[model samples]
Target chain A: MPTHNRIDATKVGDVTVVTFTDKKILDEAGIQELGAELFSLIERDNRRSIVLNFDNVDFLSSAALGKLITLDRKVKQAQGRLKMCRIKPEILEVFQVTKLNKVFDIRDEQDEAIAAF
Target chain B: MTEQSDADVWRRVIDLPSERGSNREVTDDLLTQLKVFGWPPSDVFAVHLAVEEAIVNAIVHGNKLDPAKRVHVECEVSADRVLVSITDEGPGFDPARVPDCTAEERLEAPGGRGVMLMKSFMTRIEYNAKGNSVVLEKRRT
Candidate 1:
């Protein structure tokens, strides 16, 4: 598959940070890769805290939102936490509409998100 | 292929041939134009999200990321609504088989919510299998 969507993951203390630089996250194949990467990162690090930084993303589809929710569930099962930050207001509204804001701890800035962990 | 004043409400239909690297800029331009029209932030976001999902699906799945195949997108704006249609080159799939996004087990799977989001935000969604197209309508309300 084409690597049109890029994702980078790193560890911040006990927290795992995944940054997506893709212009958009759509399609079945890309979403599968995203879910796999996130799950592996969590399982490998056993981190209770995870931060998804969408500072560079301008759009996110419901499929991508589903992945976030799924990852959140995984984190909880592992006794960890999931947080999201730097979401654009446009993208943030999607979360609000879907009521995902209640599921994930959202912060306004990356620093605040990391601090929340 | 026509130019109008920046302030004019613009509308057109373009063939989204599967020439892919990234069509993000094109999608961005459309959203920007809609934003300029004073589309409420939520509605704007919904339209952008829906368009991106539809276009990306066309580029990736429908056209198999083939630069040779084409996807067609049409946009129309009246005083109260925005209507867009996206058509792809692939054989197409059955919309009936799409699992419900709200289902508990399928909640975390990436990439199954395009139809769901379109249905949720758009006032009307019509799938034309004969044309391999999906039409979306969003009202100003």
Candidate 2:
């Protein structure tokens, strides 16, 4: 069995800050759960901005990236925004390689990511 | 008759759905298992990426979203290395035909980085001729 990683979310002002504590996010089940959770947050709270804090995350898989992309599209469709912060170098490389850096607003710090809204 | 000695080998098998969403949980579990087996953070990350790539390919391309089909993942860990094998039920594709992610035109593509990440992180990678199976190994220092 794979590790059970934790994801925590809190509201800071009008933005929803989601923190991923999982070191690795791979496979389909985990991604689906995460996607559903994020979507519910957006739908229930009417939040216009999202700050995804990856401070404890060390790696992310393409499957995970796909979910993020889906969330990004949803956020944009709602005229809200999704921002990523504290991405590890390795994970950041994945974003760069996939050219998702251009698709989502990414920052090096949580404060910067939140302030971008 | 000689007695067989127990060696420090770790093994696990996981059933993966053909859907793309299950990839994250399996990968997280696998990485945690590796860490419990004493792999360093760097080695764990590398193996994790390689495994993700293989599983993604198996689900997205090999199985083609066939929910009835399943992907099998196996991992073997020794004192100094780890080996991961992923097998899919669908007919495999030619690994050679896969576009190089580093190529100029495809560099901007969002999905092609899986193979590149697997190659870059693992010590060795090989695909069976049927393309239904991929085996990856990472050596821990």
Candidate 3:
């Protein structure tokens, strides 16, 4: 149901790496599509481990952050793990400022995130 | 110091319909203008994030995503600072009363984080008496 060019998903072993291709994830439709697609992966498809790579996203809205929080909660409830990697420094500054860096598992590289599992 | 006229500064004023995709378009346009003005990437990132949060709050929280309402954005970019004001036509609420999102109990609550993020990224923030309008300012650092 998440029909959009905003996100690209790939499987690296047992991990689903969802890289956001959009420079800005501000539109409600794209944000919703992302949330839906990730939700389906964990809840329906039963993908236990996920890594959201933000290497390409230069901008994101609070709505999108809120959606990520929801997805993280869903993953935890399902006993799955969710990690984020390759977040731009500007974006990572947001997580640090909000203290969300403590809430989620974030890494500096995709390989690091994958190895954590 | 001599006062500079409005023409001396880059300004963008938009009265947008409370539509879903309006925030993205406005943000893109604002960032482009800021970039053209030669703002540092770090400063641009901060201002961009703050503006996005402010617009989303105005459209979603203040106006409740009602198409009948309108959101007004005024952006003024200068060599030393960027000032952006967002006003929504809706029943305003007190920003002071917003619960702290950084608190342990409220971290997971989807609300208040936008306000927190806006306050965090912008160097100076102020709300109007009615609380329907917010101004975010960031001095080049």
Is model 3 an incorrect, acceptable, medium or high docking prediction? medium
Candidate 3 on B36-67: residue-level lDDT in tens? 77888988989988887788788888899899
Question: Model 2 misses residue A95 by how many Å?
Answer: 2.2
- In terms of DockQ, which candidate is strongest? 3
B1-141 in candidate 2: lDDT tens per residue? Answer: 111113677677777788876666656666766776788877787787788678878888889889999988877776688888999998887778889866667543445667777877889989999989999988886
lDDT of each model, Cα atoms only? 0.73, 0.77, 0.84
> Where in model 2 is the C-alpha error above 4 Å?
A1-8, A21-24, A41-44, A56-59, B1-38, B59-76, B99-113
Q: What's the distance in Å from true for residue B70, model 3?
A: 2.1
Compare candidates 2 and 3 on lDDT and give the better one: 3
Q: Which digits, one per residue and each the tens of the lDDT, describe model 3 over residues A27-74?
A: 788888878877888877788899999988988887888888898899
Among the numbered candidates, top TM-score falls to 3
- Fnat of candidate 1 is 0.43
Please give the TM-score of chain B in predicted model 1: 0.85
- Model 1 lDDT tens row, B1-141: 332433445676566668653555556666777777778877877787777777777777788888778888777665467778888988887777888755666545554777777777778888886536888888876
Give the local distance difference test score of model 2: 0.77
Interface RMSD per candidate (angstroms): 3.6, 3.6, 1.3
Which portions of model 1 miss their true places by more than 4 Å? Answer: A1-46, A53-58, A66-79, A85-93, A96-117, B1-8, B129-131
What lDDT tens digits, residue by residue, belong to model 1 across residues A1-117? 123235776777767677896766765567778887787766765667788899888766766787787788888898888888889887776766555676678999888898886
